[model samples]
Target: MIHDVAIVGAGMAGASLAAAIGPRARVLLLEAEDMPGRHATGRSAAFWSETYGGPAVQPLTTASGPALRDGGYLTPLGSLHVGRAEDDARIERLLADFAGSGVELSRVDPAAHIPGLRPEWVRGVREPSCAYIDVAALHADYLAAAKAAGAEIRTDAAVTGAGRRDGVWHLETRAGLFSARLLVDAAGAWADEVAKLAGVAPIGITPYRRTMVQLRTDPPAPEGLPHVVDIAGNFYFKPEAGGRLWLTPHDESPSAACDIAPEEWDVAVAIDRLEKVVDWRVEAVERRWAGLRSFAPDRAPVYGFDPKTPGFFWCAGQGGFGIQTAPAASAMAAALLLGEGGVPEGLDAERYGAGRFPAMR
Candidate 1:
């Protein structure tokens, strides 16, 4: 069947894109896995901090705040960053860099909030505007909206090849062949591979491995506990749905595209570091898993059409901020594909466009 847009990979990006494009365009959302969000989107820390990404990316985060808050996906959880005395300068610089970005933050004595944490651990800052996102709910909401908008979503439909024919895209999949006027590549880690299949130059998108472990705590549920992150980003822990806590060593090792597994060494490193920063004890590990976070060479998201390819659009390299930035980024992708006037109001697409990485070509 031929659609107006054939979206590859039904992760948060593709799902949200399908929703944003709506009934205005005939959209076909495809996923390779049996379920959607089986990759990076499913494995996120589920945070929505406005000051999370670089300066250029902050606008998208800011613009996405309303949807995240009003859509019933966000809950205030706050975020805290601890650094040793030696790391004071970097921590201060980070705070200064994000001064007026709307992330409410302040420097506090670490020992006061964290009983056993030493004074040295309090050298950094805290961001009160940070919140935990209901990732599953967010993705599900987008999927439901997309479906209601007349977008067709297909799972277990992997695109093996994509080519241009008569000014349209011919996508070959195990399920069947489909055609579309435009092709949207939201394949996450396989984004570069998808571009290659479509005769577009690979954008040097590299996927990095990140591991997380969920641990059972003694009691109290740690209800008001905020996400604690090392100033150096060595490790981070946030309270989970129940009394459990999700922890990670924040490893960003380069890896090939595949189902990522947790390395014992990485898990050990997280445990060792986490123990030093908190008074609580990790009784047992309930689960351990890993996922791939793909990035462009510049570490920012890539959203727009390929300069060389007429109808092929690129919406990849969201890195770890895919969940939080999905709303705005998807809107940006739809706007660019439809060639609409200047990205709804506050978003600056020029910064995140695929053309930003000329060196990658």
Candidate 2:
């Protein structure tokens, strides 16, 4: 049997796309793991920060806010961007850049936002619009909705090869052979590899490893602490349940496509940075994990049909904003894929298309 579209991953990107397009097309959601969201989606400590993805990505993320908020997938955690006095210019530029972007922003004393804030952290920018994302619930909901819409999801279906034959995408997967009219490269970190398997030119999408550690602090993190991020891009941390703090060094080490392990050095760096930022004492490192955030050469998510290869579509290179941008990204991708002209408002749909990458040609 032939499906209308075959999505190569079952993570947030693929799942969201499936959820959006499943009603309009027969979708086959494929995952190499025994279950969906075993990679980045499963490990995301995501927050819908309007400034997190920079200017190009903020549109999609901002556009997604309504759906995520309406679905009750977001909680008002707020965001604090802290920096040294010397970094005032950067902070001002940030405030200026997003002045009227619909993302509420204001300057506040670091001490007010973070308990026991360091003296050097003199500059602070508060974004009240940012909120923590319920990633697990969103992923599950997307998969469930997709399935309910008649999309077939097959776990452990790693595609070994793909080729176009007789106007159909023939795929050889571990589960079995499958055919579809269009193939979406949503394999996350393995997207470039999947493109190669389909005899299409690789788009140079690279996966970077990011580490997160859960710390049981001596004083126990405050329940009302906002998600704190360093303006210099050194670290970020937010309070978790059970008096734990989820922390990251904001390290983006280059890595290949695979199950990633957190390096001890990275964990140490996170602790070191946290120590300088706040007065919280780490009684124990309750847990630590790492995941890959893939990106294209331009660092924007690639969408739209491939210019070089027909029947091949791109929904990859989401980097770290995949979950936060899923709602609108999926809507935009589905509209483009379905030949519908109704793209989401305020989303610069052309910037994310595959045609922008001359390297892929």
lDDT of each: 0.85, 0.92
Clashing pairs in 1: none
Cα misplacement distance, residue 155 of candidate 1 (Å): 1.3
Candidate 1, run of 10 with poorest lDDT: 111-120
Q: Give stretches of model 1 more than 4 Å off.
A: 218-221
Question: Estimated TM-score per prediction?
Answer: 0.96, 0.98
Per lDDT, the best of the predicted structures is: 2
* RMSD in order of candidates: 1.6, 0.9
Model 2: residues with Cα > 4 Å off, grouped in runs:
none
What lDDT would candidate 1 get against the real structure?
A: 0.85
Give the true-structure RMSD of model 1: 1.6
